[model samples]
Target: MKTRNLIYRYLAIISIALGANFANAQSFPDRPITLVVPNPPGGLVDTSARLLSEPLTRVIGQPIIVDNKPGASGNVAYQFVAKAKPDGYTLLISYSGYHVGNPSLMDKLPWDPVKDFSPVALLTVSTNVIAVHPSVPVNNLKELIAYAKANPGKLNYASQGNGSVSHIGTEIFKQNTGIDLVHVPYKGSGPAIQDVLAGQVQLFITTPPSVMQHVQSGKLKGLAVTGKSRHPGMPNVPTTAEAGLPSFQLESWVALYAPAGTPAPVIAKLTESVKKSLALPEVKERSDAAGVELRYLTPTAMDALLKKELPYWDKAIKSANIKLD
Candidate 1:
């Protein structure tokens, strides 16, 4: 009789534990959710975060507030979300560069991009354009390569930061072209673009959205986009491959992540919400105007993408000898 009673008691405890977990998952996100943007205001990440707030709020029935905590190339926000109570209230809106590239460049990051965060969904991919100062006298990639070979380190290229998307893209371009062009890192895209226009830098690898206005005004010349296909918005501009640099291709993508300990059901729901938002016509239009290709990925697919990209960027960083420390 005692053994049977013991079994019943054990079963009762198991049932209670399961019930509590079910309750927690079912009642997940009962409060306002904070989407942390690990960049300063007025940047691509901040803009994307604001764009997502309304749609996500509507879908989740809770106000989704975007918080900008920019520093260490998105390490600040990553650490914040990683240590936040894993109750689904805090989230990290990470760019592919930070999730994939920083891990290889930064000496000691506070959070593990893969292990400390749960992949929720991919937001969008924003491609960059290779623009040079008007004085460079290079009409296309070949001319630029010729000029760089002759000038060598006289040709300096500015990027958003030391280990930014543009910096890495330029590095890859240099590796493929076998040219010697110096790299100049700025605080963010804003300053980099400003200096590039003022002729403080001879070349810039920047995103379309940030440079489209200047390119339109003829302040900066659009050389090539770092994508396989030309952007629809900038049909006149050729792709890196089309411009004669075959291996130069890169894009900045934003994705959602929660603390690793968050419940699977919570991740599923968040992923569904992001997917739904991306499917909306207005969301698609906004992303397109910003030169961002909107493609929502499931958590499983996001995990796969991170796994693939991490190693690729690691190799690139090592080959380029990039070290943030």
Candidate 2:
């Protein structure tokens, strides 16, 4: 009789616990949700975050305010989310630099990039392009490589900043091909592309969105893309493999994350909202316009990608000895 009574009590407790979880998930965002961006205002990352906010807010039935916490190479925002109460109120807008590339650059980070957060959904994947000014004598990647080899130190390349997507990618290209070109780090892509357009910088490996308009307008020449397949937006540009530089492939991506220890059901609700937001026509259009390919990768897939990319970038950044200012 005592055992029977104990079993009944245990079952009741389990039922109540499950009910609370269901209620919690249903009642999520009882208040405003903050999406923390690790970029300053007006950058691509910040712009993408704001674009996502509208659709996500509608799907989640709450106000989603974007918080820009840019500094320390994304550490400022990352640390903020890491230490936040894991109550689903705070979320981090994770990108390649903090999630994937920082492991290679920083010796000791405040939080374990892998453990400090729960992956929600992937937002964007940026395909990088190798573009040159119109004045360059090369039309394709092959001729460009030949010309760069012949010119040696005469060819210079531009990157957004040190330890950035462009910096690490271009360095890998030089490492694989044994090319000796100068790296000119700019405050951002605008200045870098300006120099390239003015015939001051000969080459630039940048995100398609930043340089695509210039490429389309004939101000910048598209040589090749650092993707496995050609991008539809720029169908004329060949893939790295097609351009005979298979070893030089690099892409940057962004995702949504919540602090670790958040309730699983809360994560599930946010994930569902994200999937729905990504499916919306406006979100798709905005992402494409920003030159971001929306993959809507699930949490599990994003976790797997994080694990895979960490080691790859670690090796590349270590070998390149990339130091950010």
Candidate 3:
């Protein structure tokens, strides 16, 4: 009789807990939802968050707030969201560079990208552009590679920071092309682009948004885009393949994530809202203006992407001999 009573009590407690979780999921965002961004305002990640917030708010019937928590190459924000309550109230705006690259670059991380967070949505993807100072004496990708090869380490390349997509991508480019360019790391894209504009750095492979206007104004020469096709905003520039370096390609993406233990029902609700928001015409217009492609994947698909990219980045980082820790 005593053993039967104990088992009954345990099952009863579990039932009550499940009932409470279901109730919470039913009323998931009774209040507001905060989207925690890993980078400061105005970059691609923050831009992607703000772009979704307006439409997502209408779809979810709750206000969405964006919070910027930038530091430590995005580790600060990653750790913050990793520890947030799994109540579906706090979500992370994750960037691909930090999500996949950090695992390979750092010795240890406070959070596991795969284990500590549940994928909510895959948001946006943007390809990087290879731009050079006007004075570089090269007008096209072939000429640029030839010039770099002839001059060797005389060309200095500016990256967003150490372990950033720009840094690692450029290293990969160097390995593929056999050209030597010195690496100069900056805190973020703003400083890196500023120095590039002032001719303090001769080369920068960054997102089109950062260098589009400058390229248009003739301040920088856009030699090639590192993707399969040209960016709509810069239709005149050829892709790396078109520019004769088919193997050199790089892209950065942003995604949404909640704490690992967030209930499945709540995740389903959030995913539905995101799908609705991405279909909005205004969202598409704004994303185009911002130089990012609005690419949405279901939670399962996003998880699959994370799984596939993690080891790919690990191999790339190892090949590049990059270690941050």
Candidate 4:
């Protein structure tokens, strides 16, 4: 009798908890929502978050606060959101570099991108541009490779960090072309681009939006864009494929994530909000002006992408023997 009573109580408690969770999911976001951006202010990640905030807020009928926590090469912020309560109140704007690529590049991670977070949406993609200081004698990707091989480690490339798209893409370039160049890692793209412009670094592989003005002004030499095709912002720059490096192309991407256990209904609601926000005309215009391609992927598709990207990056990182503390 005592055992049966205990079982009955346990089942009743589980039933009640399920009911409460379902109810909460249905009425989710009664209060404000926090979107944690994993980069410093003034960069693309922060800008993307700020742009999406108002539209998402309006769609969800709640105020969306963007919190910037830029450190540990994106670990500080991503881990923060990963540990937050899975209550639909906290979300993360996960960059492709740290969210997916870090697993391969870093020796350890504060949180598992695939396991600790629910993929809410795959937001946008920005093609990375490869540019050089004008003083360098390289006019294009082929010339850069020849120069790098002839000069060996004399040339240095600037990247956001050890595992950033700039770094990974550059590393992949070196691997494919068999060139040797030193890597100079920065905390963010802003500082990195500054050093590149000042000629402190010879090569900078970053997004066109960050270097479009300098490229146009001839302060920096735009060698190639990393998309499969040329970027609209830098139409004059050929793509890596066209620049004779088809295997060495990468595009920086952004995505939305919630804590792993966030309720399904709440995730659905948040995904819906993302779709709605992306559909807004003003949002489209702003994203285009920012040199971002606004592409929204469903949660399932986002998850699939994460899975697909992991192994390719893993192979590259392993080949390069790259590691971050």
TM-scores, all models, native as reference: 0.90, 0.90, 0.93, 0.91
Question: Which of the numbered candidates is closest to the native, going by highest TM-score?
Answer: 3
lDDT by residue (1-325, candidate 4, tens digit) is 9999999999999999999999999898899999999887876778788779999999999999999988877889888988999998989998988877777766767899789999998888888888999899989889998888899999999988777788888888888899998999997688998999999998998887779999999999999988877878788999888988788778888899999999999999999999999899999999888888888999999999989888888888889777774
Better of 1 and 3 by lDDT: 3
Question: In candidate 3, what are the lDDT values of residues 1-325, reduced to their tens digit?
Answer: 9999999999999999999999999988899999999988887899999999999999999999999999888899999999999999999999999999998888868899899999999999999999999989999999999999999999999997778899999998898899999999997788999999999999999999889999989999999999777999889999999999998989899999999999999999999999999999999999998899999999999999999989977887898788663
Candidate 2's displacement at residue 67, Å, is: 1.0
Clashes of each: 0, 0, 0, 0
Collision pairs in model 2: none
Q: Model 4: which residue pairs collide?
A: none
lDDT of 2 by residue, 1-325 (tens): 9999999999999999889767876789798999999999875678778878999899998999999998888999999999998778899998887787776777887878888999998887778999998888999999988888898999999998998889988988888888888989998888998899999998999888778888888899999999777877888999989988887887888889999988888988899898998899998888767777787888899899999888888888888889877
Worst 10 residues of 1 by lDDT: 286-295
RMSD of 3: 1.9
Model 4 TM-score relative to the real fold: 0.91
Model 3, global lDDT: 0.93
Where does model 2 exceed 4 Å of error? 1-23
Candidate no. 1 TM-score: 0.90
Model 3 stretches astray by more than 4 angstroms: none
Q: After superposition, how far is residue 286 of candidate 1 from its true place, in Å?
A: 2.5
